[model samples]
Target: MIVCHCNSISDRDILSAVEWMRAADPQTIITPGKVYHALGKRPECGGCLSLFIGTMEKSDSLGVPAVLQNLRPRRGRFAGK
Candidate 1:
């Protein structure tokens, strides 16, 4: 299915790009922009963002690497205190 009409990006394109990125760098965080870059395209209208993200979520390689998980400090009333 076509996720981003402006960029002609498909579900497969996003999935493939995600897998390729994971293979290239297991610790790298995958984002919509990264996926677009990997496919050699850029987002245009921003209408397909939600769907694009949904498609990306379907990929097994989209999760943050184990080593990089929970590395950020919590942000709440007392997060930085």
Candidate 2:
């Protein structure tokens, strides 16, 4: 299934890129731009962003690594400082 017509990217391409990125760096955050870069392509019209993201979301390797998650300080950490 074609996800980005401008880049000629297929669902498989996105999935493969995601898997490869995850394997290369488990802590790296995966995004459309990163996927495009991995595939050696770039977005043109920006029309396929939603679908591109949808395809990426389907990959199990797309999730942020557990170690990298929840790094932001929670609310009220500096209240009334």
Candidate 3:
């Protein structure tokens, strides 16, 4: 299951990267760039973004960590700014 043709990334590779990152740092935010770096590759053309994101979303470890969750300053907090 090739997720990113430009980077030659597979679905398994993405999941492995996600799990490795989650295990390494529970608070770290996982993104496509991080995954590419973990796999020693880089994205090209941006053609695989949709599929890449789709694959990443399938992994349970892809979610934001509990400790790092809900820190965003929404409407009320932003009103003062």
Who wins the lDDT comparison?
1
* Model 1 C-alpha lDDT per residue in residues 9-72, reported as the tens digit of each score: 9999999999999999999999999999999998899999999999999999999899987787
Score each candidate by Cα lDDT: 0.93, 0.91, 0.91
Poorest stretch of ten by lDDT in candidate 1:
72-81
Predicted structure 3, TM vs. truth: 0.86
Ranking by lDDT: 1, 3, 2
Which 10-residue window of candidate 2 scores lowest in summed lDDT?
Answer: 72-81
Candidate 2, residue 17: CA error in Å?
Answer: 0.4
Per the 3 Å backbone cut-off, how many clashing residue pairs does candidate 1 have? Answer: 0
Ranking by TM-score: 2, 1, 3
Off by over 4 Å in 3: 73-81
lDDT of 2 by residue, 1-81 (tens): 888888789999999999999999999999999999999997899999999999999999999899987777667866444
RMSD of 2: 3.7
* Best by the TM-score measure: 2
Q: Provide the RMSD of all predictions against the true structure, rounded to 1 decimal.
A: 3.0, 3.7, 3.4
